[model samples]
Target: MNFPRLQGMTEALRLTQAGQLNDATQLLQQLCQGQAATGPRDATVRPRRVIDLARALPKAIASGVVSPGPAAPRATVFNGTAARPANSPMPAGAAFHALTYSGPTGTRAYRLYVPASYRGAAVPLIVMLHGCTQSPEDFATGTGMNVLAEAEGCLVAYPAQPASANPQKCWNWFNANDQQRDQGEPAILAGLTRQIMRDYAVDARRVYVAGLSAGGAAAAILGAVYPDLYAAIGVHSGLACGAARDMPSAFAAMRQGGAAPSRAAAGQRTPPAIVFHADRDGTVHPRNGDQVLAQFGAGLGMKPERQDGQVPGGHRYTISRYRNGQGEPQLEHWLIQGGGHAWAGGHAPGSYTDPRGPDASREILRFFLQHRMA
Candidate 1:
């Protein structure tokens, strides 16, 4: 481990635990800049929103009403270096509601998105998990999934990871308690899915989960432990399940993709998955994406078809597809060339999205719609 960098991250975690969220985020931003991480180390940096959250965090902390969710040590480690687009108009057409979900593990708040055109018909449901320091609105804006939801008539859910649960607002994918069946975050997320399905006319078989970075790792965990719930999984720049159990190993996985986590016998069932990763991602090594397909695709007993292509005026990419005996693709891995740690083919309205590559949102949904819960 890079001791100096680790020390900085550790201090950031302490700041978050002490309710100094803005300072922690600012310090994290400073550390993200290569040259800044080398210089006066104490350089004060303030991200506009973190400062705003700092004002409200105290109130939430004092009231004791904040949901105990999950958090990360630093946002930059998961969010990347993309700038939030200026004058980007807020998206509409999807009516959103703030709701809460309680399961065997715990309770957490979430936002539900219903298309304006919906009446009373069964539609697909998408459970989107945001990165650290992000909310439903941010993730919605960034991924443009809501806009697609409006067009496609699918329900969308954005689960919040409160500071009380995770000081960094990241899903606790690194915690052992959160990595299993009917336990921890996985249980809570699954419960949230079932709740949404019950409250709305959601097609149980079409339910899917997707997330970025830390959320992506948690998505993998969900697909692994609760394959029956999520028909398909989308992981954008995320690690494989059981990649790490703590900060040390998590950091190791981020730096140099760790060994594939243990899994059940090959005869068992698992959810089909789609992955997006940029070869030039600086935060999470691109090798982790390779590990994702390798880990899950291991037991498939077949070779994946490899194809290469390029997007006009954007990034080049390679697609690796694994197939079942019927020749249907079970896994799709997109390796974007020259892509950083941002959503490929995402709009500028949201953060950490690269609009240069193929549209991941559309492709993932297309891939997801091909599979359903058995």
Candidate 2:
């Protein structure tokens, strides 16, 4: 098979940058066709790269910026700037792969991103969870978070929700099974954290979790049940506790087929939190977002102190930050006035996403870096 030429890939990237979606897409298809003809040795890898490019092109077009085509045919488009001007050297970081571990049902998968800063020295770890029906790779691209992690000198892990857990791949945050003591989904997630820590120099004190929608609720549960494991948490366009009662209720709540769950144990240790939501979010009620802010604010014995700020495109963001005391670092609440139930300023490549203003990924990373377990 004829492999996609390096020059063609570079040109496609240029076209994408120029907002030429059709041309970029056509080139991607041509690249895929070329991969189909490659011999067995390189055949397997090429198609994967093609798929990555295919999935990313639409988003690049949506964002009005040309995308860097996939580095590997079948793999994600990380470090695609590999062929760019050598002036800006690539940072040294271990390229992570999908790793599987056991959960209640069967095997679960997650992707890890470690920066060059992650030498033998302990470094902060951030777990970025995806919303319903999303994969780790999808979240990684849609959120553009790995770049932030690289900039911040941290390790990023994306926990995946398998279809077996929920048809929509929503984490069972609303389920009693997922939130229980030591033997449920919480354990499984924490186990993954431990495994990553053991395999890498993870700074226990600086561990954090952030998620969107269903994944956000799961991050809340992680901070609640395993406070010692995660120092901080971020929830975007998600509900506060009391979104469900049991597994059945959880399922119903997720499908929007039932009411919110009853409030569970508030848990003793409260990890500092940052919440992001759009006042106009149609899918997840903005009220749910308020409840989340209220819960964490109250935990710190305070209320949200509002500040005014303007984001790109002159979009105004109401920042409600809370703190425990004088010495405590503040937690932020961003109520994007006209934003939707999506990552703020994210490309609209998938459903349940809003591209209104500030980048949630960058804000979440900044929030994670501020606080640690006391």
- TM-scores, all models, native as reference: 0.77, 0.69
lDDT of 2 by residue, 1-374 (tens): 32346666666665544445445556666666764322223212222111111122233332222222212111121211111111233366556567877755346689998776666788998988888768887787667677677777788899888777676677766666776657567888888888888988888899999888888887877876777889989988776665665554443333232353333246566678898877655445566666666555554467667898765442468887776777475568888776555666554443344444566777788888888777
Top candidate, metric TM-score: 1
Off by over 4 Å in 1: 1-94
lDDT values of the candidates? Answer: 0.73, 0.64
lDDT of 1 by residue, 208-309 (tens): 999988889889999888877888999998889888886556656766786676664577677888999887765567888877776666455868788988
What are the runs in model 2 whose C-alpha is more than 4 Å off? 1-93, 103-106, 246-267, 348-352
What lDDT is reached at residue 204 by model 2? 83
Which residue pairs in candidate 1 collide? Answer: 69-165, 70-166, 71-166, 71-169, 71-170, 72-170, 142-350
Q: How accurate is candidate 2 locally (lDDT)?
A: 0.64
